[model samples]
Target: MSTPLWIFDTTLRDGTQGEGISLTAEDKVKIALKLDAMGVHYIEGGNPGSNSKDIEFFRRVRELNLNAKLTAFGSTRRKNSVCEHDVNLKHLIESGARAATLVGKSWDFHVHTALQTTLEENLAMINESLAYVKNSGMEALFDAEHFFDGFKANPEYALAALSKAKEAGAAWIVLCDTNGGTLPGEIGEIVSRVVREIDAPIGIHTHNDCELAVANTLAAVAAGARQIQGTINGYGERCGNANLCSIIPTLQLKMGYGCVSDEQLKSLTGVARYVSEIANVHMPVNQPYVGNAAFAHKGGIHVSAIMKDSKTYEHIEPHLVGNKQRVLVSELAGQSNILSKAQEMGLDVNPENMKSREVIDRIKELEHQGYQFEGADASLELLLRDAYGGTAQAFIVDSFKIMVERTGGAMVTEAIVKLSVAGEQVYTVAEGNGPVNALDNALRKALVQYYPGIRDIHLSDYKVRVLDEKDTTAAKVRVLIESTNFKDTWSTVGVSSNVIEASWEALIDSIRYALLGMDKDEYVPEFVGGTHGLSNH
Candidate 1:
């Protein structure tokens, strides 16, 4: 590895700018602690000048012990205003942050158009604001907004902006690709010129407007920028900022640069997930490095090759990022896909066993009829076990009925479910806001008395997809139910012409899977594929 790369995380400040991302002050603190534990060098918390919430966050964060340099973000002192009287800079000092990052206009066009101030005055703003922050005993950093575009339009003026920051005792002169339009080659060239023309330490910040934020950040680093600034999962305004999730691993493992310790690097996946969860944003399944499907293999040929030599289809050992290889079973699956999935689940299905072949055929047949097992591990596991007669007959679901009344007075929906648990017939009735919920309640009411564990399983998310929209109302519906036992989560799937029936099928598998736990030692030779007739289900 080469020289250490300073990681400046702006997730708290910039990440919240992305649409649908709203983090509370508590959420910011939680994310900050995660970043601190993950060994980031600096964290640009938030702009305390504009948002009152950020002021509260700064006050709360002061009580916590953290290792990362916590910096408050704000623009330079207002144009033509005294730096000492600037409200933005005043808030930065009062916020109790250890450092302050001041963003100043660099592009000549923005100086004349946006700020409506003379270019010289903008330079003064950059200089005085940073100087005041530094004189206040806080580390001062300069963000040259639109530096790439400024350098393209007026190279001298852009370099002049950075010179003012250097003269103000700025600790890091960060070049910002604010518009995010600069390509990799141009970013490298401009950053290289800035590095040579200025005698200050260089940093890089970029957006994803053109989907090159990560690329531009890497370009700047390649051209002698020592610090990289970005956000977790690339959450920011417009297309978002450069993603630290991808940049960290690329720098540490692939580019021969030391960003985080190997142990800290392992926590990168967890950090990304935790931040996404708190931000209430869903990570794209194909997101690089940290997504659930990043290392998943679905093709039969790929699974076959990987089973023999994992390097054949994998880039790196997934465990390095705290993830694991996943084999997805579908119509595209081969015998190898079945065997690989079985191995992943710790099932002892032999590669040469005909039962394994039977399971593959069954999955393909079901998938042909519009069943998707990639997201329904519980249902697929049940199928695999049933083929080997390893699945125990826990309960038998019999007659079920739903009644919805919308005549005039008050709308009402009810469900009646009849099932047998250990030879004891159970009939239960329940009311709900909808048909599916009523059926879920009725079914759970019937089984909870016999199997108390059923009470622990609760549905987290429910999704239904139409297999053939051309069929319209007659189309087959695929229902996916995500359930949790408060300890572990699992997904199950069912498909039928009736949406309610599909939901019931998924609900049944969810309950059965939870009851069976998927850790059975018995693997009987006799098959019981259709043993659970689930009469009238």
Candidate 2:
């Protein structure tokens, strides 16, 4: 039987300490419920004694019926203060939490400098806090703040702190890499020694200052720690806490620890994305296991190998974490890469077909001209459809014009677009706050009449990148636009020397893609496979 490794998520508490991250009382409860659904062992709600928001969060979270135990976090009692009288400890007890975790000074330096107390007083604080919580009928855990540094400074004092907490009935005595500078080797050794000296189960709480929080966490686990404390997506102060999104999979799949059930493990990617969405942080494309680029293949050789054998390049199956493998078509892609991409898109194409070769050649030529298709799946799909003679001409663009003027200290932009929808010409004009907005408004006005579903299509995000910095204003710019029709989101790309022209190309592709799905008799339009190529303009 595999050893059980408990997952303690501090996203609501430690995670919110990250820059630009703030969660409301409602957000905390919602995330706690999600973590519970994922079978997380513990959810550190927040420091109930710190602020009114956190106090309210603790009160509101009681409304939730979660599977995971909500742990209230606080610091130990002040020097020479009664544990029952301490406000922080009193708040923890009244927070209605089943578990309480207290952070106390373990480092002798912190005891002297930060706490301005003797080492023996720090130990007393740890013991009194844990004993008080246990006597109050709540599970108690003690976090030895700065444990690694404390051990290195004075091993005797640190061990005395853990021994005191253990004797006082701490269910788990956690070692914290508070400064986050310790390496994995050092952590493994120190944790092993601490576990040997203490009777209680050991837990690991790590930060990522040296970019080794996850590594050090696993190291501690290997050295006998069963509980791992981290935040979702590694959100925390400074470099951040250990990322449970990365650590959980590593523990279960790689290290053979039973952290969560198979069903719960699959929800890792969704939970990571959901937390990022709620926090208003951009989901990192390169985050391991849960990122968009985690299982994406862009290189020609890599794509070809992945087609033959996924294990050739990928370490683990993408679906294991609820992420899908993506084959990116780009300048580096070869003929095999194109064929594999086409097959993945459910398109019927032969590798030996001359049209396929022509498509590959065209892609190479276009990529040489600074038009990248890797990030523009919609545009690549349209190009492939045209090559396979499956092009659906929902609308034909006749012309478009954009004008900008400043009047009364305000800038106004207007766009006029003319298009032929099913051989009937439609002209529309619209005003907007910017040139792109005006063009988008005008284009939608022209198309929404012919295709009512087009009204559902909206631009979610737009990004522009310059290919050359030396040319400055004259440099070719690539515009990537993300569009959604309330059902699915797709990305399209356009490149040109003129920013407006680039935006226009992307906008047209976006509208056309939306119209294509509607023309398919309610079937969702996906990237279909075909000859991979770009047409010469």
Candidate 3:
């Protein structure tokens, strides 16, 4: 039988520490509900006693009948203070949480320097805080703050702190790599020693300043930690905390741990994206497990090989993690790639009769001009349709004007748009926070008269990436626009030195493809029965 490891999510407590991210009580409650639905084992909510928002979050969550246990988090009582009277400790009880976590200094340096107390005083704090919570009928967990570095500096003292928490009735003694400076090798050795010395279950909380947060956390787990503490998307101070998104799949699929089942496994992608959305952060394209590029293949040889056997180019099946493998067609696409992508877009491609090389060359030419089709399959579909002479003009842009003005320290932008469809002219105007948004609104309004379904097509994602960061004001920026309707979602791209122009181009193509899809109801067939290619049906 495989080992069972529990996940402790700290997105509310630690994730909000990221720069420029501040979640209100309502926001935390919404995310907590989603996490509960995702089947997280525990949620380490923020220090309820530290702020009114967190106190309210706990008060509200108590009435939720949540699936996951809510753990109130804070530091241990101050030196020489009684845990019953310590405001931090009292706050935990009043916060209406069933579980509580208190972190105390384990490093000798932190004990003496940061807390301005003796080592014995810190140990007393750790002991009394846990005992008080345990006596109060709450599940108590002790965070051995900076335990990894502390173990390196003073192993005996740090282990003694764990022992104290154990005797005081901590459910788990969590070792925290607070500075995120510990390596996997060091963590393994330290955890091995600590696990042998303590009778309580061990946990690990890690940060990512050195980008090894996940690695070190996993190492500790392998060495005997039964609980893994991290945030959903790794939101926290500095480089952030260990990402539960990566840890969960790795434990279940790679490490042979039987914590989550196949049903819960399928929620991986949605969980990652849902967290990022509630956090109001753009999803990182390259994030592991659920990233858009995680299962995407682009190179010709790679795509061809993947078509023959997915294992040739993929670490694991995309479906295993609730994701699908994608074949990106651009300058890198070959004949097989063109056929594969065409099939994905529900188009047919006969290699012998089709202009496969011509399409590849055109894709390359457009790529050289900074137009990327990799993330924009809708744009690729339109290009293929145009190449096949199957596309028709939905609407034509005649002229557009943008105006910007500053009012009360706020920038007000407006757009005026004119269009000609089948020789008939139409014009519209709109106001927005930016010129590009104004143009998009105005264009969509004018077209809604001709195509009412345009109302269903809404922009879901917008990205502006600078081609060269060194070219400050004049750097070319690439814009990616993702559009969605009730049926499906598709992306389109554009590039220009002007950010607004690039956004406008992508936005226009996104809408065009949305309209184009409405006209084509026939499903394109895939050409299969090849022995040399990967499986596709």
Candidate 4:
């Protein structure tokens, strides 16, 4: 049996505080429901009194029977006002949540500089706020804002503030490294002292300014903190908060803590990607657990050894986190890697036909052109599928033209596509926010007439990168688009000097891949005798 640590997610609250993510109330609820399904124990919805969207989130959460407890967050009542009389208190009550969280000044400097209040007055406000929420029949949690700095600056006052929250009935007292400048050793010592002093369970909230948010969080956890508060993808003000996506896996697989079931942990990467999609944020490729590069092995020696025995290269099995090990074929990939990836994808290597060299040449050429197959295994699978004649094309793009213009320097891109499906010609025009979107929409619209199932598949992601950022004026760009049907998600890539041309190519391939899935009958036999079967090798 493994010890369970509570996961307190604040993606809806702190994550939205990032530069450009402001979801509507409906989007918030949708994300909340997804988070609940992912099995987080608690959700810090938002500060209800702060804005209409947050207030609406509380109202909507009240109407939901969410698996995770909804926690309404706000600050302690202002000085000179009783918690019961504070309008913020009334707003907290109106949230209709079963739990409440209140942040209070823990640093003496903040009490004097920010609040313009005496230390004694700040203590009173903290105690009064926690007591009022407890008396109102709600579970209360205290966020000791700037706690580390406060503890270091004035240990007695910080300890006193935490003691007040405990006396006032806060279930958990969270120590916040608000400025994100605290060292891990300092956090471990402080958390150890506070845990020893306070009877209540301790929680930790850390920011990433110094790039130690995850490190500090782990240190605090080791020091008796039972709850971890963070946002997915490390999103927040400034650099961001500790990323729960990274934290959860480290806790479960590496640290021997069980924050979630193995089944849920296996789908962790999928959940991380899913949330990023809803938030409309680009998934960071280098993110620890769920990132594309997490389990990707690029070297020939590493790939060969991993294929023989995964433990040779992998710290933990990739499947444990719903991610699979990938052999990245590039200029660096040797015959061993080409063989390994080909075998994994159920490709027929045919050494006699010298397919390895041909495949390696193609991969190198594609790499030179800025096509990264590492993040798009589905696209690679499709490539392998086509190379072996596993799946025949249902349609092919004959020609396409796209026009893009900006009104007042704002961009508007449109696509005109022509294709032949089953020897029948079709043409369509569509407009979109960008060239890729427009091309994708037009292609899908044209294909739907012959294949109505295309409607079931939708584009889930579109990523474009300038190949040479330093030479932007003369740079080429690459585009990768991920699409999903009811069952699986596949990524396809395109590259060209022109962004529009790259997007168009990727869009056409994306629709073609989706259509390929519909033609499973065509590839079932070819794969049966392929590398996935031992006899083929």
**lDDT at position 114, candidate 4:** 99
lDDT of 3 at 488: 54
Candidate 2 lDDT over 1-537, as tens digits, reads 889988999999999999999999888877888899989999999888899999998898887867889999999999988897898899999999999999998899999999998878888899998999999999999999999999999999889999999999999999999999999999999999987878789999999999999999999999999999999999999999999999999999999999999889888888887787678776667899988788888888888788889999998998888777887887777788778767875678977779778878888787787777777777887777666665544556677888999999999999998877777989999999999999999988887776677777778788999999899999999888887653455678878899988887787777767766677555433222111224322
* TM-score of predicted structure 1: 0.87
Deviating ranges (above 4 Å) for candidate 4: 351-353, 366-379, 403-414, 433-436, 450-453, 456-491, 496-500, 517-537
lDDT, residue 65, candidate 2: 69
lDDT of 3 at 29: 92
Score residue 186 of candidate 4 by CA lDDT. 98
Clashes of each: 0, 0, 6, 0
RMSD of 3: 6.0
Residue-level lDDT of model 3, residues 394-500, one tens digit each, is: 56677889999999999999999888765688889999878878988998888888778888777778888888889999999889888767345578887789888
Tell me the tens digit of each residue's lDDT in model 1 across 12-117. Answer: 9998999998888889988999999999999888998777678788989998878899999999988878978878789998888898899999999999999999
lDDT of each: 0.85, 0.85, 0.82, 0.82
Candidate closest to the true structure, highest TM-score: 4
- Listing every candidate in turn, what is its Cα RMSD in Å to the true structure after a full C-alpha superposition? 3.9, 3.8, 6.0, 4.8
In candidate 4, which residue pairs get closer than 3 Å at backbone N, Cα or C atoms, i.e. clash? none
Model 1 spans > 4 angstroms off: 389-461, 482-490, 507-537
Cα lDDT for residue 122, candidate 1 = 93
